[model samples]
Target chain A: MNFKNFITHTLLLLLLALIQIIFLKNLALFGVAFCFLYLLGILNLPIPISHVPLILLSFGLGLAVDVFYDTIGIHAASASLMGFLRPYWLKAISPTGGYDDSAKPNLPEMGIGWYISYSLPMIFAFSLVFFTADQWGTGGFFGVLNKSILSSIFTVVLAIIVQLLFFKRRREIR
Target chain B: MLRILQFLYSLRSFLLFVLLEVLAIGLIVSNNSPQGAAFFNSSNAVIGTVLKTRSDILDFFSFAQANETLILENALLLEQIKALKQEPDSLPIPLDSAFEAQFQFTGARVISNSLRFAQNHLTLNKGSKDGIKPGMGIFNQDGIVGRVKSVSENYAVAISLLNTGLLVSSKIKSTENFGSVNWDGINSKQAKMLYVPRHVKAQAGDTIVTSGYNAVFPEGIRIGVISVVNPASDPNYLDILIDLSTDFSRVNYVYLVENTQIVELDSLHKKSEVVNEF
Candidate 1:
């Protein structure tokens, strides 16, 4: 287990959460907004560091958000599943060891196309699960599906923007 | 069997996704029950505090409108008081059956209210400690808002007139003929009474008041007026639209009416549980 990678993952998740709470929540483009960017931190974590711990971490992060926002364990349950399934999906998608053991998933490290391919599916899966659970408590099946799709699309776009803008330029090495 | 087992193994993620989703649904459905609900509901102290704080922040913006409404209502009350002095022999109108039943006014402030939602609720700044109980009627000088639904130590939440779940028994002010009024969910200013029957002569301006068919509210408390009446919409019942007398978006101060006789009535009813049909 690389200590630097864990620290990077924690800092990134907290920063995304801060941005989501303070800024992006109030930002609406035609009433569609991104809020679950913090999931990227979990998604970007390297595989084989025991999936259970990461899933628990995602669950905790989601519960923290719910506590702040007054939704129940909806987000927590969704993110937990995403974290549990993370390793299996990573193995299935990237058999060539695309991600480094000591590194984070960024454009400079994995290239834009590999990053896009890797991140988009995880982003979709996680967002689909996260917003769907968030809605199930308040809204029924159709409502959950609608919010899941909209939030997932918005999340993916923002995830790419964050990838291209902040992490893309700051990379000192591949 | 091996092929089926392989298929099951391949589909484990999808099944797990569904299982998690069901857990959430189960949480919600179980929350509807009396006991299984407390775990994940807003009853949780942390969730309640968060919602309370967020609502408090949102309530700040509505203060200006609320103040203007209170001032207007106060001025109108003063005017009525002055007018009553000029015209004697007219006793001041009494409110609530609780007065007849010998209960007192429980003062409470509007903490939170939602107008635009399909289902709406209001939270008041008083609760069981202040003698506010569930099913106690809440009102201002103008008219009814709702009855308390849930109560805590220092606060209570109400199912408002704007709620789709609420079915209030009301009467036309002139005839006192009763009907059931509910929010149609399309308009905040309008509610509809479906089973009023077309036989009665209802006009566009007739006032509606509580009919006291139910114990929730006393008779003659104002609800709204018949703003639009389509008698021909259905043969048996008239389709009536009501313009609410009280602007809910502006309500602030309210009186929570508590009936002390309820305990006695409940005890008597419990004692008389076995009725002799003969």
Candidate 2:
């Protein structure tokens, strides 16, 4: 990524984290689903970013969230797992024609179908791990499953809205 | 050697993944341990400040409800005072000893509260500097809330009664049959009371009050009302559900009750246990 792109991504990540902590932290739908909008930062990274950096970035993002939520390492563990599996998920869902090198995996660039298919699994994976670790031993299996699924759906919907509203569609400069 | 190095390099991401996850698990395990205390919790300074600020903003919107609660509490206190004045010599022996003097109450605002989780906690604005400490009982006008878990300089974390880990010694006020109340982690508004004998007559709406068997709470403090009474699977006991008096969703202000004689009482109890061993 170029220096300008790096700077932009960093600022966007910070902004998303701030929004998650200040506004979205207390928000729950029907007292079950919760929005973890901070995941947008990790999900939208440039496809070419290396595995180590990606994992580190996700760990940092999760730790930032953990600090605010007072949840210790639960978010960090989930986000790290999500980051490690992102490349494999991308490969599994690669278009028949293959992905363009410069295009970012976002709603506008990847289209809604591809975006949902890609983001949903990633978010679900994160939520499953997050909730499992969070409610371990205390919550029954059904309780963990309930929280993970509901929270993932809530997060994904908010993420889609955020991407559609704020992320401008970039023109290919071929 | 070259082949092994190549294989290791190929699995670097997986290794990194495992390493980070292990580290994260380590943190969770360590922090949740009894010895971990509240170092990484909402009661810590940075998170506490943020939550306190948010609660302050939210508190503005609940002024009317808060006013109503205060008025009701004031009237109750006034009534007690009037009764005492009317019959000074006839005052209850417990009241004659200055019931208020044995406990010091510090008012606190709850900055962060969670009722959805299996184990829930409340972060209060009062802390060590405010004379708040672990083991202090917290209550509001409606009823008992919980015991303080840990305290920072300016913040304290209380284990909410809704938490499964907290068991309150309670009794049916009408019959004086004692039981212990604990959250089953299913409902936020209801808790289970155990150990009341199957033969004991308990009905829905019977008041449940603290037994004060544990010195954390003084006797006769209101806890809740029995909502459901059922025969336990074991014929020896009754399963009773209680509707908590404190509506945790709207509870913002609370009083931390510090018992002046707790230390002495605790020592006396320990001495009796030692004597029993002899």
User: Which candidate leads the pack in TM-score?
Assistant: 2
Candidate 2 residues B1-278, lDDT tens each? 99999999999999999999998998887766645654477778888898888888888999898999899999999999987675656655545655557777789988888776666788899888988978899999889998898889999888889777688888899999988998887778999998888889999999999987777887899999999888857778998989999998888899888888888877997887743110
Q: For candidate 2, what is the interface RMSD?
A: 2.0
The two-chain DockQ for each candidate, comma-separated, is 0.17, 0.60
Pairs in steric clash, model 2:
none
**Model 2: per-residue lDDT, tens digit, A52-79?**
9999999989987786675778889999
TM-score of chain A of each: 0.79, 0.97
lDDT (Cα) of model 1: 0.67
Off by over 4 Å in 1: A1-170, B1-23, B33-37, B40-62, B80-125, B137-147, B155-166, B171-210, B218-255, B264-278
B23 Cα displacement, candidate 1 (Å): 4.4
* lDDT of model number 2: 0.86
Candidate 1 lDDT, tens digit per residue, B85-193? 7456666776686447544566777755656434456767666777777778877777888877767766676767876667787889898677898877656788998
Most accurate candidate by lDDT: 2
For residue B62, what is the lDDT in candidate 1? Answer: 76
C-alpha displacement of B142 in model 1, angstroms?
7.1
